[model samples]
Target: MKDHLTVVKHPLVQHKLTMMRKHDTTTGEFRRLLREISQLLAYEVTGELPMTTRRITTPMEEMDAPVLAGRKLALVSILRAGNGLLDGMLELIPSARVGFVGLYRDEETLRPVQYYFKVPTELGERLVITVDPMLATGNSSVAAIDLLKEAGARNLRFLCLLAAPEGVARMKEAHPDVPIVTAALDERLNEKGYIVPGLGDAGDRMYGTK
Candidate 1:
């Protein structure tokens, strides 16, 4: 979390990402790959979680066992496409507290509009990780973080499958303290605010919709 951004270069994550980027990948296959890649990414993102040791008796003898410190970590999905990544992360961290923030971009302005918001209590006492598949314009990501902060979350991390340079910069300017973890940072965002070389709309691809 020291660095502003961390790109997971693990081989498995890269291979699965390539399959997802292919236009020919079917909806079912895309969803499967995303779930697989998401678990791998989750491993990297949770590396810094605080740990404490508790004395426990094993079959052999009593010993100190390390466990997650304090309250369970909070996982907030940025709604819709974010659920794709959220689902997989949950499989890996089943005990994590879950929440959701619903927001959509205005086609003309590309700004995020919030429609729903919910999260775990005592956000300031636990690590909060926000999951969203793509960070394109950063408008929605920043806005989501803004809302989370207002809710009292102090420790925060942003996780995504892909990121555009413009979006990364915007997030840094808006919330430099929140680190970003992504599978890959693509070349750039197109005029329409989509990441170039990124797999098409994650939500649409997962659902097999236009």
Candidate 2:
């Protein structure tokens, strides 16, 4: 992790994202597209995971195969919307340890308020990757990462579908040690703290809620 942000520019990601942004996209289609995109994003996010050699018998003969090194990775979701990303990533890394951090904004202060938090054991020994669909204000993402750090996670990364510039800058300022990986970085956040041109409230769109 470093002061870095990776915006995935894969053609598939861009195409699916465009479909999701359309107001007419149904809940079922949106959810399906999200799952597909998450798997792709997961591929990029885990591209650099450390590898080690393991001696194994192949169809031909015994050989050393490259396997993931160290403990199982931790996949922590940032509440409801994060679960959408989590579902697809799980299909890719079924053995990953999972966790969740729940937070809501305080209307007056517009700050994150924690309602629930739980994480896997040996977090310090595992590479922790937090998932959330959108990074608008960055308050919740920063707060979630803060808690992960407090829980002893040493290696950390953030994943999202879309992010506003304000949120990216805020994350850089708050947790420069944690790198962000997103599908797209949008122009800016509107006054209501929503990412402009972002697929509207991820949770709502995914679940067909108000």
Candidate 3:
């Protein structure tokens, strides 16, 4: 509910998400919707990136063109569903360095365990944006951000396709400095910790996997 967490309510983002939520949508359709949402979300995520002007040839005389001013950003994805969102965000900021954090919750303790992680160097200098499709329990997302924090990421943010109130609250309490941009924050988490009225399992929908 903080302004720091920008919940996008734009019509295009809302419409696309509605289509994606439909059970009749095909895997390709789901993938396309995710990509579209990611691209649109990228605009907000990268709104404050530093920019400077540079001389460029415009098929005529030289002209000044704006370009990114400082260190390239790090776009870390909480895999494997995060990769679905990653593809679209990358299209908007192709220069951003990529990273991945793999986390899966154990059914018994319901704790997140990391399976894989690899990030670019100099995280402290560049802005870091960690992304995932669903912020259900926030355990995995927080764990992944912990890793990024350990890697020297001071200025960080998160991008998710959807979120549950419990998940958002958890993230806010744990890492208040890290801002979040999401398409929608649903009602609440169901018994199994899934966002109610959510877009089901984003991993399954995006990749057509069960």
Candidate 4:
């Protein structure tokens, strides 16, 4: 992943994202697409994970097999919408440690207010990936990363399904050391801080809520 951002333009990812962005995509379908697309994005985000070879016997003979190195990496979901991405990622990395940081955007101020935070131990020794479906204003995402760092996470990456330029810039300015991976970088944000042409509120769409 680049130091700033990596947009996954894989054909399948783009296709699924389009399906997800459709206004009339059903709730169940939206969720399934998010899960599928998230796994694809996970493939990109975790591509450079530290690898070590271990001697293992195959059906034919012994061989050195490449495997992930160091402690099991942590997956920190940025609440509500983030859980949508988290579920799919867990299917791909079942052994990964999971954590959650609950934050909500203050409608008027567009600032993030944290209500809960819990993360894995030995955070500094493990790679941490924070997942959220949208990076709009980036207030909540940045606040979540701040909390993770305060908890001792060093190696960190931010993953999202869609990003607005404003949110990407915000994250780059606030956490330059952390890399960002997203399926798409949308045009811009609307006045309400929503990503323009974004697929509406992910949580609401996934849950059939307003």
Candidate 5:
């Protein structure tokens, strides 16, 4: 997508996201909605993927069929919450290579600390799409991208369920070349680094934590 940040405004995406944002929604419902929505979001995220023709034979005739070009795409989950989004995307792109980056914010420092990271080999030659549920402060997202780049991922894209303006600006400033795809761009974040009018802590809500 040409836009640095593409908000998926499809009716199904918006409707499901709104249900996910409701305070009264149960964990089971939220998880189901996330899975359903991620499939749709995956469609938007992969819109610009390159395609090529592959020779194939039909029952009646043989012809060249269009197929994705280049190496199999890579799906990098930002750990914990990202796994939720990852699962759904995997359902749609079952052949994609998978990886994970684990990060947690230090309470006092409020900065992301990487605890675990493992990415697919030859990342530079693959289209790497990193996923997370929320983009609030963007610290962890930015840090994750930094690690991915260090690991040799040149072409990368970010996908999230919700994004704050601050996070969008932060990503634009840090990785302008990497496009961001999201279901919603909510209001500003609160002092605690949570997206305002967001669905609360994504991990907590999805996993039924406090």
Candidate 6:
């Protein structure tokens, strides 16, 4: 909706995204592409991150190198699907603090309820990044963000592999300040509230389950 949602359209990300959209893409292929896409998205997500120049010792000479400045990063996974993206992101920011939240929707109520919540101690001092692979109805994402907010996380951003217009709108309406970085925004969700042409259940494909 607003400038909060940044749809990463880099060629590398787009090419890998294309592979994931193909039905014939194998599990291994899908996993690999997801990792690559995650890396590309990570670059975009870290765009605004503050960096300070520091002297580096190279064989040739000493030169100033950009190092992370400002508050450290905290990555919160919206388990268990969000774990997939966490891997690649962590490879980049290995020292970042990690957190987890578990949310499952009730079939009858179709509302999200949290089952588990754990965050770092100094959440207010860290830049929060909450990740989930799919943004279908936005119920779980919104609920997860609410949980983070309650837990005292101030600066927040969302990282997702796929998103739908409906879910995007819902999230923008709820938490416009917490920007979202995603690989692709699909057409729309179907009647069943699943992202259309979306890579099917991310959890399933990732863990080899149903």
For candidate 1, the C-alpha RMSD (Å) to the true structure equals 0.7
| Tens-place lDDT digits, model 6, residues 7-105 | 998888888888888877888878887777877887877778878999999999999999998777999999998888888888888998999999987
lDDT of 6 at 16: 84
Which one wins by TM-score: 1 or 6? Answer: 1
Candidate 4 ranges beyond 4 A from true positions: none
Clashing pairs for model 1 are none
Estimated TM-score per prediction?
A: 0.99, 0.97, 0.95, 0.98, 0.98, 0.93
lDDT of each: 0.96, 0.94, 0.90, 0.94, 0.95, 0.87
Candidate 6 local distance difference test against the native: 0.87
lDDT of 4 by residue, 44-66 (tens): 99999999999999999999999
Which portions of model 3 show Cα errors greater than 4 Å? none
Query: In candidate 5, which residue ranges exceed 4 Å CA deviation?
Result: none
Worst 10 residues of 6 by lDDT: 104-113
Q: Specify the highest-lDDT model's number.
A: 1
**Number of backbone-clashing residue pairs for each candidate, in the order shown:** 0, 0, 0, 0, 0, 0
Candidate 5: residue 93 lDDT (0-100):
100
- Per-residue accuracy of model 3 over 85-189 as CA lDDT, tens digit each: 899988988888999998987767667999999999999999999999898899998899899999999989999989888889889888998998999989998
lDDT of 3 at 164: 89
Model 5 TM: 0.98
lDDT of 2 at 60: 95
